[model samples]
Target chain A: MTMKLWYWPEIQGRGEFIRLALEAAGIAYEDCARVSGADALIADLDARKGRAPFAPPYLDIDGFTIAQVADILLYLGDRHDLAPSRIADRYWVHQLQLTIADLVAEVHNVHHPVAVMDYYDDQKPEAARAARQFREERLPKFLDYFEQAAECNDGPWMIDHRWTYADTSLFQLIEGLRYAFPRRMATLTPDYPALARIHGLVADLPGIRQYLASNRRIAFNEQGIFRHYPELDDE
Target chain B: MTMKLWYWPEIQGRGEFIRLALEAAGIAYEDCARVSGADALIADLDARKGRAPFAPPYLDIDGFTIAQVADILLYLGDRHDLAPSRIADRYWVHQLQLTIADLVAEVHNVHHPVAVMDYYDDQKPEAARAARQFREERLPKFLDYFEQAAECNDGPWMIDHRWTYADTSLFQLIEGLRYAFPRRMATLTPDYPALARIHGLVADLPGIRQYLASNRRIAFNEQGIFRHYPELDDE
Candidate 1:
């Protein structure tokens, strides 16, 4: 049976990470919210009785539902061969994915530092301060860690020679950061050659290439986690 | 072989969640940072060659190391019977743990709204704003979701009658929140009867009671993730 993914239809947000993985694995699934309106998505989520997802980007597969971007990736990794076969390696890949999730959350926070419910216009000054710290410290620290992971492996993949879900997610992270802080990423991107190489490699993958060209991939905008406000970017 | 847990020596932070699970399962492991020094912990983390952890609260078992609190708990859950036997149930439990992790991160962010590297005092204004939003919206939303999970189950546990790592982690989450925001928690506690019930049940567990009475359990302090700042709390 075809799996169903429920998320906000307009923005990629966390759901894009899952979309990338399914596309990479050439798996068949329906983007439920995209097909049905977001009201339907909310109703479906509200209707879930037990073990309900806390937020969107939940997948309903074979009668069971899973949520949390990293957890969903972990479930997908096991089934789609998107992770290493060895148990230790699988955990390591998952650890990397969890770290990526942390980075994504921080990226969202840069624009919404004081209050998630508040608008960026209300938090712009705080966002500016947050963006500076993120660009200087947190972003570099995370990039360095990912680059180290790539360097430890045999090739551009997170694991030895084989690309895992972590790598695809990493590609999305780099893409998001670059879009959000083009000047900052431009200055720092050269320092992390391994990450740059992995990003390029993931972009060239046939599945990712196809997905990127398709209309199914939503363009990053102010509404999504990674927004370009120009002022949030630094040189 | 005895497992080794590495985290910041002083604060409960993320490490406490893993500690609670291990304690609940009656597993004996070394709190490596407490035995050694923080310097040693940093040296150990820095010295690892490949597949190194992004941050602390990593567990070294047998030969491999697992990082990320949820991931570490997932590993321990499988070996120590800390989670359900069924694969679907295991994933559901893990999903709950991940949500708890998200809440923990948000709690930390409430104090460090602008920059994590900066002192909380530096971001006091921003933190005040964050704390208001957290208490007004995020905290209630999270509590409501977790309470629903507990209510849906056979008992106070997140899953059926048998308590899992998720239950232990939720217990800690509630405890930390109370310690951090007593006034806010006092007003909100009655609204989440299931969570309060689970907290009471977990505290009564022999292993947890022993751990709490022992020197192993660190007292809640300002340095920890759940800092009890009077200004941050509201009635």
Candidate 2:
């Protein structure tokens, strides 16, 4: 039997990163929240007791559970041959994944600068200010680093021309940023040719192409992490 | 030869977490930024063109450079036997380290809520609100989870009786929070006795005790991740 993954049913949010990886690898697993209801998701999480994850997108397999997208990818990468076999290379890819995680957190913060629990309406002013910094400073900074990384490698992938979890994640980052800040990404696209190439390469992958076209992949919305706020986007 | 660790010279920021783990394990390494200068640190980092770290607190050892605190520690934890030997236990430890990383990022945001590049003075009102949420909700929530984790374990450490990098990180979290928000921590301290016990155990570790007493351990200040601001604290 395939393992069970638990996350919020509505938005792609952080869970989409995991979904992309699983789909890209053609791995089998059940998204519990989609099959069951959100209440079941909460109840299942609450029942974990002492070892509960701080948030969702956690995977339960063969009686062991793992959370943190990078950690999950780290485990899955090694098991399914998604990452390099060498220790140094593995750590390098994991480091990149952690950087992606940082970028994701900052993306979420742009919408909820004052408080995560607070709604966008309540924190619109702070969000506007944060969004400015993110679009003007952080977005370019993160993309430039990744573009340089991809260029340094011999091929479109992040490491040694191979499709590591980082490559899939970079694709998601680009896609999510485009969804959330279409105008800004359009303006900035010319500067990140390497990232653009990698994104294209990942999009062409058979599994990803199928998954993206299918209903299993959720749409981006205000409820998600990378929300498309028109006020938040700028050239 | 010992590894070379690069970070800011003046403050105990993210680098201190790595420093604490290495110190707790009695691992020898040169604090490159302290010996050389902030300029030298910048030059060294800038020179790693292809895969440079997004920011500081990176480690260069045996010709391999690793960034991200948790990744560096994950690499070190296995070689130095600071983490568990089993694969499952190792991933578990890494997951905890990732969670600690999340908490560390949130702690930094409390002081610079509106912008990372902006001074606290410019975002005082926003910082005040962010700090309140952090101190009242986030700090307790994170500490509570870790406290329950500690209680579930057989000993004072995060996993089975042996000390791991997670234990060292928990120590840094507690110490940093106390320094950054003394009054807030004092009020909330009674609720997390397991974490307190883990902190005490880590403090008493002979190697850590020696390192703490030595001049090598940098003190907390305004420049670091955990900064003291009277306005951001509440009883």
What does TM-score give for chain A of every model? 0.98, 0.98
Interface RMSD per candidate: 0.7, 1.0
Per-prediction CA RMSD (Å): 1.0, 0.9
Cα error, candidate 1, residue A12 (Å): 1.3
Residue range with the least summed lDDT across 10 consecutive positions in model 2 chain A: A153-162
State what share of the real interface contacts each candidate retains.
0.87, 0.70
Candidate 2 runs further than 4 Å off = none
lDDT of 2 at A64: 90
User: Model 1 chain A: which ten-residue window has the lowest total lDDT?
Assistant: A154-163
Error of 2 at A1 (Å): 2.2
lDDT of 2 by residue, B1-235 (tens): 7999999998889999899999999899999999998999999988888777988899988778899998998899878888988898888889889999999999888877779889988999898889888888888888888888788787768997889999999999999989889999999899888888889999999999999999998888899988989889888
Clashes of each: 0, 0
Please provide TM-scores, in order, for all candidate models, with all chains considered together: 0.98, 0.99
